[model samples]
Target: MEKEGLQRSVEFFKHHNINIKTLVTDRHVQIKKWVRENMEDTTHAFDVWHVAKGMKKKLFALSKEKDCSDVSPWIKSMVNHMYWTAASSANLNEDLILAKWQSISNHIINIHDGHSTLFPSCQHDDLEGRERHKKWLKPGSKVYEKLQDIVNSRQMKKDIPMLSSGQQTSELEGFHSVVNHFAPKMIGFSFHGMLSR
Candidate 1:
């Protein structure tokens, strides 16, 4: 669906009073616009992993102009830090820290700022919200508990395995597998195709 269709869907959800606490999406202008216009109360968050990937892409692009490879890792680490900070709270201090880090390359930093602006306003005490999220986890708390159990089981396997050379990289490995399965065949595909059903 296009922007208009997304807007319509959001309107319908709003009309029906859907309990959409947060809308997670990539940085798409249409989705950003629709969320701004219709879902003022809903929390809007761009996916952290996507933001990091974008930063990495831009860093690679900038490497031609200025040898950014030396500082690229630092910049990426800082970018990830910014995501955690922004995800935690909307305080000006965190924003300022992010701004300062991006100021390495003014142009690149500006792009980062543009990405940050797409999200809804965050509050200083937003970290409290993360704690509250635990109470509302999907499939109930039991599911999360079971997940923890499975993780513990995997750790046990690692310790007791008859032969082991490398550490388990299940989460990261699984992430790449899923990305390969679902990401577009080429770059610049429509956001709807990339994300929506």
Candidate 2:
């Protein structure tokens, strides 16, 4: 089913003379692998929200750990950091993306300054004045380690580049909700029901 949808989309674009430079989607296992093997001409990026969602699930699970109980509360902030990491590294390569992402361990410690491979020190300005309500976590703490593990995982690394800087599926999801209002999934549609929709 996923392959058929992809093939149909490719055919539709080709028929309409639309040159697809990139394809952004949630990290569906089959689709991700299929696109990598088949769509060499197009860059595949995973949706930032989906990547964050995956991280949230991991963090939630980790929060149950004996030393990692504190991680549960910080899940929301960590998800926001995922978006921040993606947005800040716009027009940059995967290495920069990884560097910025890895720097979060420093950022959470109220150490906005960092040492990444691409940048010797933190690139952003000092957050001294604006950074109120700061929640600092030690780098070597179990919660921090769990958070880092989730952020630095192999799947997150692979999907970092395609994290959307401009386009987002939030609006698309909203549109689907509206469509469902018109053509709800629960009811079986007759000819007139379909037309009404």
lDDT of each: 0.45, 0.76
lDDT tens digits by residue: candidate 1, 1-197? 65776678777887998867666655566777778887778756555555456555554554444323343334454355545544444334434434333332322222223434523333324334433332222332343333223323432232111111122224554786778677745666587877752
Residues 49-95 of candidate 2: C-alpha lDDT, one tens digit per residue: 88888777888889898887766657787787779877777689778
lDDT of model 2 at position 132: 42
> What overall lDDT, based on C-alpha atoms, would model 1 receive against the true structure?
0.45
- RMSD per model, one decimal: 20.2, 2.7
Clashing pairs in 2: 45-162
**How many pairs of residues in model 1 come into backbone collision?**
0
TM-score of each: 0.41, 0.82
Candidate 2's error at 170, in angstroms? 2.1
Q: Pick the candidate with the highest lDDT.
A: 2
